[model samples]
Target: MVLGALGVCALVLGWRALDLQVLQHDFLARQGDLRNLRTEPLAAHRGVITDRANRPLAVSTPVTTLWANPREVLAAREQWVKLSNNPVLNSRTLSQRVEANAGREFIYLARHLAPEQAQQVLDLRVPGIYALTEYRRYYPAGEVTSHLVGFTNIDDVGQEGIELSMDNRLRGTPGRKKVVRDLHGRVIQDIAVLEEAHPGSNVTLSIDLRLQYLAYRELLAAVTRNRAAGGSAVVLDARTGEVLAMVNQPAYNPNNRSGVQTAALRNRAITDVFEPGSTIKPLTVAAALESGLVSVNSTVDTRPGTIRVANKTIRDHRNYGVIDITTVLTKSSNVGTTKLALAMEDHALPAFMEHFGLGTATGIPFPGESDGMLPIRSRWRDIETAALSYGYGVSVTALQLARAYAVIANGGIKVPLSLEKVDQPPQGERIISAEHASALVSMLETVISAEGTARRAKVPGYRVAGKTGTVHKLTAAGYADDRYVALFAGIAPAEDPRIVTVVVVDDPQGQDYYGGLVAAPVFGSIMAGVLRTLNIEPEQPVGTYAGVIDREGRL
Candidate 1:
């Protein structure tokens, strides 16, 4: 009786254990499905970028991807051979195919497949082969807008320029849906809704396509004429801080990105910095006049063209005698600007620099703004101060120089530079008195006259105030070669300034490498085209543009 009772208990325990193990299998499988299932990141379409006129600069286009699950491919080896012959794949040998197909149960055959190629693969119905939907960023303007629109990586991430800066807003969220598959590996009814992605917002830039083309053409011509290593140009609306056009040459093809790292691909206008040379003279003169150190008629003792200060001999490009402060700028006299800068407290200069947006990013909203160097006043020597007066011992990006001119063009108010559309204009701080600014404008107008250096910069229908600069390129050790950076920074229609431009030709090699010849003509050509494109009525009256600069080079 005791043995029978023990056997019965053992049987009951055995039966209970089997029931618990088998009956709980369903719960374990559900937990596994929760842990193992996942959704991969899919890049949502990037928004289109258009010029102010709503012409496409960049747009996202539909593309397809080629993928394969080797395990699912039950096709004969010969059929696999035919599919591998695709030019995109370029598999010549069976060994290559085996090596490529080795190890991975699933592999991506190609990304960004052309529609035709993808369709061909689909028609073949090559079992394991599949096509995935994707999108690609395309610059419809082609090389015309590459520098501004920029290109994305294969992963559709913006890498530079406006693309990088506005990437977060331009790259939309992605969506996913979970579904159960049949034994044949086909998607069935939706098991779960993973997420829905929001599309990226469109970006509208301040650039006008017509002006952009003009600027690009002029810059290209300047580079070719000067035999320069590279060049950059920018045009800004003086009344409004709108950037109409910008170009940095030795550019790249965004559509084909294999050689994107070329040195010229860099945006010299906003990214690179250099000693501004005499292009900065107008600012110093403006500062002097604003501080009441001198008037436009103030006579600076610039006799002898050279002066010794703090163990350094400060010399001009050439000497001038007893020139007024205005002539000092007209002739770009280094000694005169030095004397004027010396009269002001050394520390007060930084205030002007700050107002003009030098030594700081202009915040133009492009990527890689170089905050050019400006040392403390206390660290300056007499020679350094003199150098600073003539735009040396200081480095400033091209955009910064344009900003300074913008302040003068705007009648002493220095507004922040902008790239996007603004419903309401931004306010600016007063940097100089309006009278002083007008005085400076009068001086700059002389720069484009026959008696001045930049004779090529004259606009027949308008008065232009501008400055010319030529500086030696710096090497690791010091300034090297006769390779110079020739530049002109100008404002048009000084009576009612409307646009500010800065043009620089890097390492110009021809006889016409001086700013007067190399860069000034470019400014003229660009302004002429842009003015007509924007329908900016010539201040000089109809047919006056042709006479802006007479055949004899007299203003």
Candidate 2:
């Protein structure tokens, strides 16, 4: 009887063991996994941003973030107090602050800690406290490239400029893995990776750091010397349409954005639009030349320096009398440009302007890129036409003017502008006949001659072709008499144009506010340095480029 009883017990035990290990294996295994398994996030690093020459503009460095489970941390007040008063938290009062949020399931104690700092927190050995490995963006170029490179928020997310525009390419995708964990939420067993982490791909911009610094220095000086509100300068490769340099005044350091205003945050080169003044005259001249209304040598009578049209009077600085089309541009005669516009068929000037990439966004990859305003009326009146001719009715950003000039410098080919480095030059669309473009180039060249408005724009070793503009600021009460936007757009080595630059000085307060006096020198100085740095040979004799002019009374 004893042997039989023992046999029954052994048989019952064997059957129960089989039921748990094999018969009900699926359900039992799932129950075990639910209790011990967890999905963990695998951190990935953001890609570095570099210039065309691979110089670092923005990069990410390893950092640690301190997090705590409030429920668990409330029991370790002493350790919590110690951490709150630590230098890594940058606070002697954080202990009280943390107590206020004790009801939260999780809270951040400190963020962006150095490895050593994070280790010190770990040394506290508080329950439910943890450190997460993360990255913090660091901008080496700082304020110099702030407007272009932009910056990420404290959460490591992009908020402006290239960072915002290319967020997908700059931000890495976090991965996941399954792991066995202890009751305290610490990983105990390694498990299979659910997916591999995808790090962000690096970005290469067309910006030349050397040229960017040059533009930044010169623009800052111009703004300071003139006591102007602000300024912007753009340099573009005529051959490839690459933005070599873009700089703006009143810049802010992105690395530390304390007390920075939204006004200083704007990337003014592409976002801010203003009346281009006489800068649009070149496009108007191109339209007239293309419409068979005039040739490069055809003359317009600008006598008396002023004319009345449709209840408005457009005037030049002084009487230019009758002058050739080239001379009209050389003098930037508003009367002459108006006459050219009046000669064209209706919708001619605006149509040509649109084809030159005006009144539209340049399709650059940036946020808040503005498409400048153009008259939406089906037909423009005579005064409207005249104003548009001299760059008043229509508005444009500095980048648009640079690109428009680039079209002429590129022999009438309109290449799409780019902020990224292109391996090859983009195929361009012809906006005007090559012959007409050549004629326009010749006319533009004379604008830097002894008798023209921008004589100071002549580069010592390069044949510079450019125009100057001085437009009265348009206020809520109409055009302001005391404020002006001084502008200059020029091309270097006019024979074989390589680069086009545009400079805009806003609200110059000095006695000399004309574009030639204020903006042309900046253009000349920047282009001269650019040519020398690039080793571009001079197209003209050094002594042949000098000119003298009266500093006052310039249009």
Among the numbered candidates, top TM-score falls to 2
Q: What is the TM-score (0 to 1) of candidate 2? A: 0.89
The lDDT per prediction is: 0.79, 0.88
Model 1 C-alpha lDDT per residue in residues 1-555, reported as the tens digit of each score = 999999999999988877766877788778756644434334478888888888988888888887766655644345666556665554344235445686665667778988987777666555566666788888877676777777789888999888998999789788886755443333445667677767799988988888888889889888987788888888888667888888988888888877667685688888888888999888888878778888767798887889889888888767788889878988899999889878888666656776778788887777888999877665556677778889888898888888889889988888877777555667878888888888888899988877788888876676788999988899887987677899999987777788898998999888766788788888888877777777777776756555445433564
lDDT of 2 at 332: 87
Native-vs-model 2 lDDT? 0.88
Clashing pairs in 1: 460-548, 461-540
List model 2 lDDT by residue over 1-555, tens digit each. Answer: 999999999999999999999999999999989978878777877889999999999999989888877777667666555555666653344455457777887788788989898888677666667777788999998999999999998778889898999999999988888999775556789798997888898999999999999999999999999999999999999889999999998899998999999899998998999999998899999999899999877899998999999888888889989999998998889999999999888888888899999999999998998999887779888888888999988989999999999999999999989999999999999999989988888898888887788877868878889999999999999999899999999998888888999999999998889999999999989999899888898876776645543464232
> Which residue window of length 10 is worst by lDDT in model 2?
546-555
Candidate 1 residue runs with Cα over 4 Å from true position = 1-43, 74-78, 88-105, 178-194, 317-319, 545-555
